[model samples]
Target: MYQTDNLKQKIKLFMIIFFPILITQVSLNLMTFFDTVMSGRAGAEDLAGVAIGSSLWVPVFTGINGILLAITPIIAQLLGAQEDKSIKQKVQQAMYLSVGLAIAILLLGLILLNPILNTMDLEYEVRHIAKFYLITLGVGIIPLFIFNTLRCFMDALGQTRMSMIIILIALPINLLFNYIFIFGKFGVPAFGGIGAGIATALTYWVISLLAIAILYKVAPFRDYQLFSSWVRPRVKEWLEQLKIGVPIGFAIFFETSIFAAVTLLMSAYSTNTIAAHQAAMNFSSLLYMIPLSVGMALTITVGFEVGAKRMQDAKVYGYIGISGGIFIALFNGIVLFAFNDYVAGLYNTDPDVIALTVQFIGFAIVYQLADAFGAPIQGALRGYKDVNMTLVIALVSYWVIGLPTGWILANYTSLEPFGYWVGIITGLSCGALALLARLIHIQKKYRNQIENSSAT
Candidate 1:
């Protein structure tokens, strides 16, 4: 009875943490959904422009977010070990890293913006709009990174509800701004697709400022004293973080870049293809929030267990998380497969766009099933600080195997978008299987260590 009750308590705790994080993720993905839908209404060309611009920028944003993700487990473990004083310094270091990375991304975006667009073989108008969108969005990358850093910090402390509230508030604001700018409402001239970029930039700034204010004024966060003193960048700390974060960043880049590559390749086909791809991708992202949320929660949970020197508990939590994620993926996959046409219609009314979107959705369902296992297992590894291998696996699966196969199938066969999606499935499946195997190995090793210590 005690054991059953304990298991129930753990499940309840996981739900409490998981739901808010899931909602927060959903809100973030909704921003992209809004952008795509609004742009689609403008025209096919506008939709394609947003799609291309999103492909270019999402990788940059996600890569930086992945790098900053190092902060979460660091803080989680610190909190778990009751090492409260150490958190302030680490938080400060993360802030410095965030600002530096934001600036670097901004500069890189400026340098490569035009040249990258020119090489894409896009239509003149599409290219022009895409360039405008990319530049406008680029202006906000700094604040976006800062916001992400704050979010990660709070998440580590198990304060996801506040973060979810802030993001939920931002959603309506994003929509209002997108409406006013994209359609030129309330006396503003229509910026069309580029207007979505402007809205996104403004939203990032608002969210960043709000997050900072919350960290400063919130009663719970006051305990961390994150803002008590400003510290100069420490070479040792920064290098240590980078040592952990760079592999994470590269792992994210590998997965995201494959999709970006697919988007670029699809650009050569037709505007309809791009628009269809955008719809399918956006919906897939929305569904992805499920496993991703669970995975994120697993990171904090497992990190806490590890910090408490409860290796067996950490392993148990990892198993629960991975299993829950796969189950959710199966449920979502069924829904998507059954209702794909309805979902596609929600994005665009054009028959051609809808038809292509349905086909792409089929691929997305398979990809999600693989991703269900991949994402959470990766998160479990992060908690164990077992990341470098995951990076190597991602590189080999996505770039070495996935992309080349996709290229050949997409270019040489009649598969077109289907071929690219097949590649996504292959890569995600490979990643999932590899990570799961690693997790089993690590669990065995840790169990042996525990047994030896007990014997001693």
Candidate 2:
């Protein structure tokens, strides 16, 4: 019932789109690493403070990203089906919902940061630094919805390279702000950890604004006018998006919680160990961008196919995405594993910290490959609008297996920090295996049904 194209072109398209995204993400991640490294040099407490606060902030920000993702695939499908009439209306509705959700998350972050730091039971300096970091981070996050709304529309129209360009502008600005604000270089006051917070807050606003300008200037969004109609969201459409988005949000939270919990636990180790762990994690974050960007590309392609009711085409796109991820992951893994010592040293200079970071980096490389396989599968599921089942797998993987496994191994066994990383491995393996099986099963069933109908 559905027409399909060759996998080679699909792979090519995925890569072509992914390259820019990968570069943007890697650049942005390096900016973050630079910020953390700057603070780490000021003092371990300064570094620890930013690390603790960032863990809390990122999940909240990511939750909004997850919610916005719900609208993107639907927009993709709508594009493929040539449903131009409803496109503006659907995007407007999703934007309205996203703004509300982003505000809510930002507010929650603002209100909870103090309560959270109060409970961290750290030294007063650490707690003070974390609290300041969170408050400023929250201040600038309010405009995040604006960025996502434009980006989502661009994504639906197959214009993701613009995201790279926008971030390219923001990356240098962030580094500049961090340099001036953190160490007070160039005659600025040394804000230290507080300066990192200030720089981060400013970076978000710059990226959000810069991204919009880039979208309007360069992209082919002449069809979808972002300012044309500021109508109230249709109640019916809002309900539909929420029904699709909320479960995915929960799944994002489930995964974020495991990583956050582990990062917090690592604080129980020596300050240097925590620093080492953060460096490795920061680098891993960069590696993660490859799979994430690939997954996103596949989602767009697959969603386009699915909306056209070309199920086979969708499956092929998924295959292309996963293959792309495997190749990228293997290449990056080999490089990271080979240069674990150098890679860890890039974040901090202490010998013990570097050694610990090397250990974590080795584990992260292996886990990233597993994560690479899983990330695209999640994106594919999103493409098919298959959030509910994926949510179950995420819940079981992170909450059921990941959290408890890490705690038991890290606290009770001799593995300690390495034990905690095994949890990341378990979660990735479960997510990848479970989602892969589900994707195949669904494709097989749908294909059979189509065949049966044709026979009739």
Candidate 3:
């Protein structure tokens, strides 16, 4: 939104947008971190159950949320292009699409939950907890979807701080709920890991209601009159958004589901192995929030510049964002490398679990730079609406190349669980290279188009 081309101003704007998003994302992931830590204290079985449930929930939820994420770039571009009149309707249509998707996912998840768990070679307790956890977690799907829709809307308008504040408010409430539920306080039966799911479901509803209240009562957002008029859901608009959204959705799904797949593969190992993997992954995910936030901010900044027909400015933003992300990742990797053992001990007291977790975090450290590199570039591509190729790249990189290599290495070699991490590192590095190339191509094409138009 800062119109000045000054480098200092650009960096300031990027930071202004990036920091709130960083907090928001960190807060969101912390909820999961709390769930893992609290459930782990309850029992190893509890921790593994929650981890498996999360593996199922994450891919499905993020994939669908990725579709709704299209709203950010769409609205950002609309704002940049000064197409304000169309914003309200697009938002309404997205809301409708979200509700419909939530209901379908909930119902389908219910039908498939038992079948999926049955297939996993899990302990009886682990399987039981995983099944019920997902079932309880399903209660929040609609609200979560709605909350994300509102969050994306707010974010596109450079109002990242609003969502940050709302989630900050939700964080303690979520922690409290987790404590009360997981510990069985106040006459509630101790449901262990399932309590975490209940707490999360309740927290989702809390955040959704808070977001709606903020939007209605807050200035500027209220001026949009988003809720003022009824816009009937039209198939045409749904398809239009989906055209942009589906690729983004599946691209995220493919990438995230690899982690989920690894979690699933770990199920056949000892309960300790599963627990260790989950803890390391949970910590790794917390670290990942940094680069991920950078990418989300890039989508907004780059989308706005591209929409304003300033391809060069968009390129500058991409460079700033990507470089900043990698630098932070290097710092994170160093810290994580130095303190991984201490970090691992935060999850559980069992020495074996801690040791395994520390080893896994080492692999996480190795991948940080590559992960930082790819994530924000994907955000930049979304800004250009160049998402379809990203989907293909993600599929090929993670599934075709990464997962297969991991499977062979884990099953056929001595590396065992650590082999999967090697594969993940390899995949992330490859994806980063491919994404960088694609971003370069898109930038050049647009620059040429602009030059020709100016010459004529």
RMSD for all candidates, in order, please: 2.1, 2.3, 0.8
Clashes per prediction?
A: 0, 0, 0
Clashing pairs for predicted structure model 1, backbone only? none
lDDT per residue (tens digit) for residues 1-456 in model 2: 123367666666766666876787677677668778888888878888888887777666666677777787888888889886878778778777877776787667667767777776577887788888777666676566767766777776777778777878888898899889888888889988889888977887887877656645653665466557667777798878777777777777777767777888886777787778878887888888888888777778888888887888888888888887889889889989888988876766778888889888878987888888888888888888888898899899987887788888988899998898998888878888998999898788767877898899
Tens digit per residue, CA lDDT, model 3, 228-260: 887998999999889999999999999999999
Give the number of the best model, judged by lDDT. 3
TM-score of each: 0.97, 0.94, 0.99
**What would the per-residue lDDT of candidate 1 be over residues 122-210, giving only the tens digit for each residue?**
99879988999988887788888888988988988888888898999999999999999999999999988999999999999999999
Model 1: worst 10 consecutive residues (lDDT sum) = 1-10
In candidate 3, which residue ranges exceed 4 Å CA deviation?
A: none
Runs of candidate 1 with Cα error greater than 4 angstroms are: 1-5, 454-456
| Candidate 3: C-alpha lDDT | 0.93
Model 1's alpha-carbon lDDT is: 0.87
* Reference-based lDDT, residue 238, model 1: 85
Ranking by TM-score: 3, 1, 2
